[model samples]
Target: METTKWLLDPAHSELTFKIKHLMISNVSGAFKNFSAKAETEGMDFSKANINLTAEMNSISTNNEQRDAHLRNSDFFEVEKFPQLKFTSTQIEQTDDESFNLHGNLTMKGITKPVKLTMEFNGIMKDPYGQEKAGFLVSGKINRSDWGINMNVALETGGLMLGEDVRIQCEVQFVRQGINVPVEV
Candidate 1:
């Protein structure tokens, strides 16, 4: 068929990010509650529409104290703004398998443009005969723009946390027959 919804297969998909911690190795984490949707046929991304959301309280670094701090008023203020969201405004084709997705990202009550580089991995049919599509997306965002800067002075050098955040996403979509909801 020529129509399908690229439903985010959360079981296999991931929304991860990394940032500099104390001028040393990067600290990585993923948003466990997030979703994205897009529509694509055999060879075009013209009608692609995608949206993503992350529950601020779901931030986890495998450290309970750190996770709590992230949910506090200093970082995410999870009680005040419980979610971060992104909605695609436009998807432009850059190549046969690549695309530039420009969208509005809302975090901590601020909104800004975040561009995501995307690659169409491929389409396949599962054992149950359900058609599926896969994609890989990555991008970098400066946390300062979204008012997420939290840091402290290091006795030896730079701040505790860096400004730039690297994000990566691996998503798989099953055909709309799975009862996927469309974002208007």
Candidate 2:
């Protein structure tokens, strides 16, 4: 078996997150700049070496003021911590399509273990003759764990923002280097 490297197709991949706001509704946002890679032996990605990084300054929530605030010390503090990163330590296959991806996530200079449930969406050959792999990833983490401890209390009683942030990713990887047939 030979190892093949994979690069993320940024145009076809997205990293998004959601958090409860005002204790009533959820606010959705996405990072506009991010990249990931994987090195795999054949097509069974369970043992792949995966890494991901996202630019904290590229966060977008549709509102410029809020986006700026998120980049400040109250949240990500992009000036001091410019990137959020994840490196997979283990991949546990739960089924043909499902997996538990164990990794360490670094945000705002804090690194913590996180497990993301992922679904392999299979592979395909695009019209451009490139082999592509798809995946759906989801996870949750407490914002406070990353040192983001800024929030206000609502006049009605509840807090301004939820502590738990739900992350979702629709990612696609394009095969790089020499093409090698994966054995069954």
Assess candidate 1 and give its TM-score to the true structure: 0.89
Give the poorly placed runs of model 1, Cα more than 4 Å off. 1-3, 40-43, 178-184
lDDT of 2 by residue, 14-115 (tens): 999999999889999999999999999987798999999999999999999999999988888899999999999999999999999999999988999999
Could you tell me the lDDT of residue 77 within candidate 2?
A: 89
Clashing pairs in 2: none
User: Per-residue lDDT tens digits of candidate 1, residues 31-113?
Assistant: 88887777656435555767878888788788889889889978889999999998889988888889898999999999999
Best by TM-score: 2
What TM-score, over all chains together, does every model reach? 0.89, 0.95
Residue range with the least summed lDDT across 10 consecutive positions in model 1: 175-184
* Residue 64 lDDT in candidate 2: 100
